[model samples]
Each structure stands twice: as C-alpha cells, then as structure tokens.
Target chain A: DQQVKQNSPSLSVQEGRISILNCDYTNSMFDYFLWYKKYPAEGPTFLISISSIKDKNEDGRFTVFLNKSAKHLSLHIVPSQPGDSAVYFCAASLSYNTDKLIFGTGTRLQVFP
Target chain B: DVKVTQSSRYLVKRTGEKVFLECVQDMDHENMFWYRQDPGLGLRLIYFSYDVKMKEKGDIPEGYSVSREKKERFSLILESASTNQTSMYLCASSSVTRVSYEQYFGPGTRLTVT
Candidate 1:
C-alpha cells in the first residue's frame, strides 16, 4: 500500500507565475514531511520541509504547507523560474528523527518562459 | 558538504549473474540506505544500515542483501539477478544529528538485467 501519494504526475507553469504541487498521505502518524527536487540524471536535493507541529514553512521562493487534519501537504513556488523545472518528491517520516521515509511517486514540474 | 558516490552510473548484467552495487559516503553518517526507483513506484527501500556491521531490512528486501563493514561504505548484493530486478538504484546517507532528517543521495546506478 502506498502511504504517500502525489496525484498529479506532471504540472506546467509559466515563468513568474506560481506553481503548486500537492501530496497526500494515508498514514497519520507521519510527523515530518520533506520535499526534494531532482534534475535529470542527478540525485535529489532537499528543498523544503515542514514539521507536523507547524502548518507552514518557507525557504526563499519555496513554501510548504501542511494540513494535518486532511493528511495533505502542498509545495508552492512563487515567481517560478525555468531552473525550478524538475521532478519533486514529497517524503514523510513518523517523526523528526526517523530514518525511514515514505516517498510519493513524484510530480514533474515544468516552469516555462 | 555531504557526498554520496555510487560505484557505477550504468551497468548491464546477464540473468543469474551476481551483481554488486557499492556506495560510499564521506560525511561519517550513521545511516545508509539502498533504494530502487521504478517508473511509478517512486523509491522503495531495499535495506538500511545504521552502523558498522549492522543492517536492517526495509520494505523490499527479498532479493537483496547488504553489508556495511566500515562506516563509509555500504554494499548491495544481488545473489542471482533476474529481469524484474532491473531498475535505477540509489544510495543515501544521513547524519544522526536529526537536522530535518535530510538525506544526501548519490547520482544513482541504472542496472539492466538481460
């Protein structure tokens, strides 16, 4: 069973516009959520993360919002740039210190000019 | 910066052959993980090692075994490879400091079983 799911397989947004990627998880025990960005043929790098204690976390142009009651989270990138185009994976862990993470299928975000 | 390196970027092996995928991390991390990525399956963990000579099975560890003789190295062994085992293998390592629990990943190894 997939504990984490990214319903959208792909997303496209024009440059300078906002891009939103959504993720849902079936396990409510997950307390820490992270987003990673992966480029072609490269390893995924950490983008942003949110703890269950907080509803939102932001890093520069990226912001991650979590809704614990709904078991859903979203990543928002304002003024999206072409460099932001990549596969984004949302991962969840039972706690902030847990080593095991359940990852979503991923959403490919394309930021165009 | 944390650096994770895999042995090969792409590998081709025949069925029933023994395949070994090696990974090394330079950050002296306490955790190392091996995962396989498929088209729609995302990344499925095969095994993880928390310390030297210590290992634990992950969600999908049936066809694989792992060894961590040293703190910097982790090895994944495929006893007898099969066609279904072909996929992109990734290695990751994270420190025990619990700083957002971020994992540093390798470039990945694309293994093809023929």
Candidate 2:
C-alpha cells in the first residue's frame, strides 16, 4: 500500500496566480511532512516542511498546510512564476529515524504565461 | 553548503553484468539512502545505512546490495543487471541533528540496463 499519494499526475496554472498541489496519506503515524521540487536530471530539493504540531508553515511565496484530522496536506505557491514549473513530491516521516521518508508519485506543475 | 555527488550522471550496462553506483556526501551525515524513481511508482527506497558497515533493506532491496565503508560514502551494487532495473537512481543524505532530519539529494544517475 502507498503510504503517501499525489492523486494528480499534472497541474497547470497561469503566471501570477496561486497554484495549489494536494497530497494525502493513509498512515496516521506520520508526524512530519515535506515538499520537494525536482527538475529534469536533478535531484529533489527541499521546498518546505511542516511538523504535525503545527497546522501551517509558510516561507515567502510557498506555504504548506497540514490537516491531521483529514490526513491531507497541500502546498500553495502564490504568484506562480514560469520558474516554478517542475515536478513536486510530498514526503512523510513517521519518526526521526529508522524507516525514514516515504515519497509520493509527484505532480508536474506547469506555469503558463 | 551540503553536497552529494554520484559516480556518474548516466550509465549503460548490459544484462547479467555487475553494476556499481557510488555516492558521497560532504555534510558528514550519519544517514544515507538510495532510491530508484520510476514512472507512476515514485521514489522507492532500495537501501539505507545509518553507520559504517551497517545497512538496512528498504521496501525493494531485491537483487541489490550496499556498502558503507566510510562515514561520507555509500555504494549501491547490483548483483546482475536487468532491463527491469533501468531507471533513475538517486542518493540522499541526512543528519540526525536536533534541527531537522530532512534529506539532501544528489544530482542522480540515470542507469539504462539493456
């Protein structure tokens, strides 16, 4: 079973608009969540993260909201730019060690001018 | 800055051949991981090590082995290459620091087993 899932394979948004990417998980033990961005040929880079203790975490143009009761989390990029186009992955970790992270299939976001 | 380097950016090997993929991290992280990314399947962990000479199998560790001889280096080995194993391999490292346990990844090596 997939512990983390990104149901949407792809998404498109116009520049300067808000882009929201969603992720869901079935494992209730997950206490930490992260978002990663990947470009072709490059490894994933950590975009943002949220602890289970908090409902939301914001960093500049990017924000990650976690709803533990719903087993859902979303990444929002405001004023989406052409440069923001890439594959986004959601990852979860149950503890600080041992099994480590479980990643989603990812969503390819395209920003149009 | 943290940097993780892979042995190759791209590699092609024939079936039944022994293959080796190397990864090195500059951050002195205690934990290192190897994952294979495939279409629709996402990144599945092949193996990971938390200390020298210690290794753990991830979700899919079949036909694969790993070596962590030193603190900064981790190697993934394929006993015999197969076409089904053709995919992008990524290496990552993270510390057990009190700040965070977020993993940092390498540039990735695209392996094509023919």
- Give the best candidate by TM-score: 2
CAPRI rating of model 2: medium
Residue pairs clashing, model 2: none
i-RMSD values for every candidate model = 0.7, 1.4
**Residue A9 miss distance in model 2 (angstroms):** 0.7
- The TM-score of predicted model 1 comes to 0.97
RMSD of each: 1.1, 1.0
Q: How high is each candidate's TM-score?
A: 0.97, 0.98
DockQ, every prediction: 0.80, 0.73
What is the lDDT for B110 in model 1?
A: 92
For candidate 2, please provide the TM-score of chain A on its own: 0.97
For candidate 2, lDDT tens digit of each residue in B1-114?
989999999999999999999999999898999999998888999999989999999999999999999999999999999999999999999987736648999999999999
Off by over 4 Å in 2: A96-99
- Runs of candidate 1 with Cα error greater than 4 angstroms are none
Tens digit per residue, CA lDDT, model 1, B1-114: 679999999999999999999999999999999999887788889999999999999999998999999999999999999999999999999988866779899999999999
